[model samples]
Target: MTSVVPVLNDSMVAGYLERFITEELHSSGFTEASIAVSGGLDSAVVLKLACDALGTAHVHPVFLPYKASSEESRRDAGAIVSACGLAWTELDITAMADAYVALEPGIDRLRTGNLLARLRMAVIFDQSKKEHSLVIGTSNKSELLVGYSTWYGDMACAMMPIGDLYKTQVRSLAAFMGVPQQIIEKPPSADLWTGQTDEAEIGVTYDTLDQVLFLLVDQRLSPEEVAQQGFEAGVVRAVERKIVSSQFKRVLPPIAKTSQRTVATDFLYPRDWCT
Candidate 1:
């Protein structure tokens, strides 16, 4: 059978997202956008969209790299920034990260990676403040659904233009937008450590993961039903588990109700609400 995931019309998606970036920023009373570019496909797509929507002068792209970050990352990041006609800006987080890493001698790669991500998050927000821009997140649907990202770390952002698009779809849009072939083709990684790829950590390739996600989430198929679609039951269940577990990353923190109206529950106001 053909792939269960739908192929996107790149041109249409591009136009819609460009408008999305523009309207989202304008609605929030902001005219500038700040992005954390990882030299990866998602960020490349977001950066390009922001530039198209608001112009190069209005979009500020910054590269935040840890000491162990790949040289390839730096090179690809530079290429995309130059392609967008924006001046290259990067900040090294090694010193900031290592300062805390030294406190805990036995901290493993997982903790260290989270530290780096949060550090990058802190820096990006500061940079956004310095430039008076809103932070545009680069996470795709696959990572967000599977809980593959660090919460309040890489996930913290003013808005996510590609948050709804899956990894496979993002790749298609990236190609259409003429993002560098090397960045699009590179194995997806957070670059937390040497030779680490997202697939290796997630235990599934995006091609398969995205298909399973479409069936289970978008199609709303039961685990058994998805398994019947020629997918291994084990993989189906694993994806379901991820979606269930990572759900916290998708929404606001829960509040224990003591009063009649509680923040984030009943006292919520629209994001664009004017006082």
Candidate 2:
């Protein structure tokens, strides 16, 4: 069995950005694209893409940090913004999470993390509304598949350029686009908890996970075929289980049975009525 690491070549990245800003940005009547810039590789790549797509002037990077999130993340987030010569602002969400936690002391850190994710989106969406822009998403396909992201939290977006790429592919594109090597090499995380790493939580490396996902999702491999491709049986089982259990996260909430063509969202919309 062979392992193929997925990649989005430099030209593909550039083309996506070009397609995004020209087709989405200008068409949306947005003067800017607002991003919730986390101090992580995914967001960094999104930022770089935004810069290339819309220029620094039209790409606004907003950093929203929770109290428990590391200061290193904060610094890293700011540094990338500065390095790219783009404008950014800080919105400390410590108070917001604290207020929610105060109301429900039993709330777990995951809850707070989701809250932070939603809050950041709220900020980005609001800014997009004000600036006549749209909220760009940073979620890669790897995270999206396993429901690793917040529901309406990090998942909210006017468009996602990298959501189709695996985590490894995201790194490839970011590196090719001249993103800092530090960012490209950093351990991936959602920064939901102190000392949290994505692989540690997910129990599998992105390389392995991406291979499984690509085989399963793209190639439509069966469980047996997937396991035969060099993945641990347990890893394949776990990934399959997560995918089944988390289908709701990837889609709209279940609506009650209704008459035909009910607007409970039987419609598949591209989010815009285009020209």
Candidate 3:
């Protein structure tokens, strides 16, 4: 009922994230991590956390930009790499994306954008293998909950340092970590197409959307209860629908329950089991 927005202690979260990254990497027997810096608040925060967690030497940041990507994306991403003195590489996926686009000349932005996202992930995974590091993800709780991410694309990662943090919380942590003000102030975007902002694509401001998500997901409130609390019934329904529809993106592909220990069915092993 109350329109109270969720607040996070940036300092506490920064420390917690730093420790989480270290522990996750250590348990996996990997001392290094590869991250795809998208020049957004979320990735910038993750980049800073990776540096604090494993040191500059252990963090490898890759800037994956395409032709449609804004120039600021590269500049902002490069600044983080320079500030941390971390070694990074850039991979221009324009040609690769064009190859697919050529197949379907009228392909919509969503399809092309998804292709680009997957290409970026493919490159990040390749770099991970080459650097002997795990792929660190930058997806936030807000995006993950609403399926605002691409499955096996931007959603792919060995471990997500900020997975539990919401988009608003990411901005808070980014400020605490001293990420560039430009990145923090800019409208959130995946940069899939020119002038495409995340809020515009999602059709709702993150402030309101996050509140709805917190009530529905974190507070375990039903859609009706959330609407009764003052949120628009339409907005509550939209958020709830996204959470249900996008559930598939949050987990491993389902396996048939034919065997006693089917993978991702009855048989699930901890990611650190091998370690």
Candidate 4:
């Protein structure tokens, strides 16, 4: 399934997110922000957006590498920092991740990859605590809807600015922002274990899935309408099913009727109320 994404030349995604960063910093009363970058399109976009929004001086990129991870990850992560002149540091999780798998025998390498993700998040949270900054999250809409990420690992962030974009849109925006084409085009992997491709794990190309998602989710098109637009109904149904089944990931915990003014549901604030 192909798509017809018009070349995006202008948007405030960069500027808006920048403004958001500044506001969050001021309101949250923090001085800096930290993010975990894997040298993939998603994190590259996040890092670049962070640098643009907060200035490279205020954005810190932390790269966590495990033994089975690619050497290219560290190299390219440096490339991103040097390109943007952002501050960065590398942490090798080889020892820590190995110790985890050693105790939990029969855990597959992919599971180990997820553990590595949480380990990195622990480090990010620790750094945020030290720097007195917020930890930024990088999960795109495509990954979030499909439950493609570990819950408390990559999904955990003090605030997320890119959760609305689909994977295809993320890459498109990355190109608009002049993110390295090599990183943009690289096969997305958690780099947890050898030869792990997101598409290979999910069984559908992001391009194909996002197109179907736009029809089903954004436009509210019926499954037949989606299929009419050159996609399989099965694909549409599958993605929709996954979206429905994984609704918990996209939302805060359900509000129970404990009180008249509960937090997530009954006590939400309206837009502009804070200002």
Q: Candidate 1: where are CA atoms >4 Å away?
A: none
How does each model score on lDDT?
0.93, 0.83, 0.89, 0.80
Per-residue CA lDDT of model 3 for 1-275, tens digit only, reads 34465677888888888999999899988999999998888888898999998899899999999999999888888887777787678889989889889999999999999999999999999999999999999999999999999999999998988888888878878888899899999999999999999999888898888899988988999999989988899999988998999998887777768766888776768877873
lDDT of 1 by residue, 148-195 (tens): 999999999988899999999999999999998999999999899999
Instruction: Please give the ranking of all candidate structures by lDDT, highest first, separated by commas.
Output: 1, 3, 2, 4
Number of the candidate with higher lDDT, 2 or 4: 2
Give all TM-scores, in the order shown: 0.98, 0.93, 0.95, 0.91
Q: Which stretches of candidate 4 lie over 4 Å from their true place?
A: 1-11, 269-275
lDDT score for residue 27 of model 3: 91
Tell me each candidate's RMSD, in Å, in order: 0.9, 1.9, 1.6, 2.3
Q: Ten consecutive residues with minimal summed lDDT in candidate 2? A: 1-10
- Model 3 bad stretches (over 4 Å): 1-3
Model 2 clashing residue pairs (backbone):
none
Worst 10-residue lDDT window for candidate 1 reads 266-275
Error of 2 at 49 (Å): 0.8
